[model samples]
Target: MSNLERDPQEIRCGTEAGERSEVLAGREVPLGGPRAMKVSRTLPNVHRRMIGAWCFVDAYGPEVAAMRVPPHPHTGLQTVSWLVEGEVLHRDSLGSLQRVRPGQLNLMTAGRGISHSEESREEVLHGVQLWVALPGDRRHVEPGFEHHADLPVVSRPGFTATVVMGAFGGALSPATTHSPLVAAQLAVDGPAEIPLDPAYEHGLLLLDGEVEPLTAGPLLYLPPGRDALRLSGRGRVLLIGGEPFGEEIVMWWNFVGRSHDEIAAFRKEWMEGEGFGVVEGFDGTPLPAPALPTTRLKPRGRAR
Candidate 1:
């Protein structure tokens, strides 16, 4: 399972967001090439490393360019591809070839290990790519992928929400999930009321608009224990949350591992040709692993 495990240190899940709500401005990261794109990373930051079981969050541009990422390796997490505009073609080691479009989802489970590639098919592509760390038991499961073209949605007066993952407003996604998480795409044309999961820590990222009456820029994080939120505006946003990941996890480049040595081993194997074997039919240069930091990776879960 790539040695990714939960920290033995017990951090109580659903820790309150505290009395202060945070407005986070994501760091700008540019993905280069002729088809270059910029993204914002909210999680895994110095201020907050994670929200619920979600450890990695990347909100990419509505850019018009060809993607060049070749088949790459991942472990201990599930990649959730949710597109708000444009399209992405996903190819994985499990022989899954799927095209992700607006309002569609592509979920890849990197249990033991998996390799996948994403290529843009449209002139412009806009989406959010997120990672859900696996629980200890599920981290070792076989690699797999699933696509949900049709998901459940709730339509009210000026509010509409699509339950992308987990159950929301009596709607559930067909895509498989390893943890108790909720991912939804919400749009508000005017005043909107949405139900929230009180048991989870939630956050919102404006794809193009704002949260009603709030003056936040683009991101608003609501700590766990809120029953609902009212929205009175015209915009699009992504709603993501779940039970907080109680354990710690170490991440480097594309791989998430349990320990420093474990991550080093994974990097060595992938770059030195020992792990994450060839993904057939994928023709492109794979991204190289970055150098490990001088300081040891922080421990999250218990040592394997």
Candidate 2:
């Protein structure tokens, strides 16, 4: 996906959000061809900005459909493919091919640039695809991918949190991260207390059931800087946090850059096949890059 051709439903969150809990709404996208997939997009919204290094979150599926995402490109960010259900075959320009199953974390770093694809022939599939912006130092380090079958988990009386990145509850994930952040999947059957880093900003995504003070519909921004929380419910929740990222990032489509020109240059390179290379063993030809903006693309991010 280039910085161009964005689905219009990817709306920016409204600014008139209430202080306590701003329930978010989602938009539907055809991730796998024509099959509609509901994406609860959380970053770039009006209520809040980046939660640490995470700049984009797209929670899709629980619904069934074969996923076939043609080869695409990404840059300046790490793609976190978290599978809650089903399995996906990942292929990238580095020639890395791995099938990610449920409970598995498939992370791809597009430091400079990378071309890749995700496909699943399974009739029933479900998962979430997220993006974490690379800090200034690691933005152009190199392109890499890692598959982790086992990660650190923190358990309480009625909740279990599997650390997808960073550390929580004295447990650290072996997963590579550029900055201090936490991404965990929490399974809850009843009331349970989960610890938090008081220095980190946090949020909640109630995936399966409702948590007290949080309904099942949107991205719930927790009162930041809290040390711990008692979540009472019978569902699954995704907890993400990080030391507030101080850098301003420009995100368009799948490419994250510091400026519009950088995005423009990358888009041109992708279309001309100059920098971003081709993915080996992909199902079909890679999706063509979208056309560049006619006007000088305006940049969006936190004020630096």
**Each candidate's TM vs. the true structure?**
0.88, 0.90
CA displacement after TM-score superposition, residue 286 of candidate 1 (Å): 2.0
Evaluate residue 148 in candidate 1 and report its C-alpha lDDT on the 0 to 100 scale. 84
What does candidate 2's lDDT look like per residue over 80-105, in tens digits? 98887888899998989999998889
Name the runs in model 2 displaced over 4 angstroms.
Answer: 1-21, 301-304
How big is the RMSD of model 1? 5.0
Worst 10 residues of 1 by lDDT: 1-10
Which regions of candidate 1 deviate over 4 angstroms? 1-19, 210-217, 300-304
- Prediction 2 TM-score vs. true: 0.90
After TM-score superposition, the amount by which residue 293's alpha carbon in candidate 2 deviates from its true location, in angstroms, is 2.7
| Best-matching candidate per TM-score | 2
In candidate 2, the residue pairs with backbone N, CA or C atoms under 3 Å apart (3 or more residues apart, or in different chains) clash, namely: none
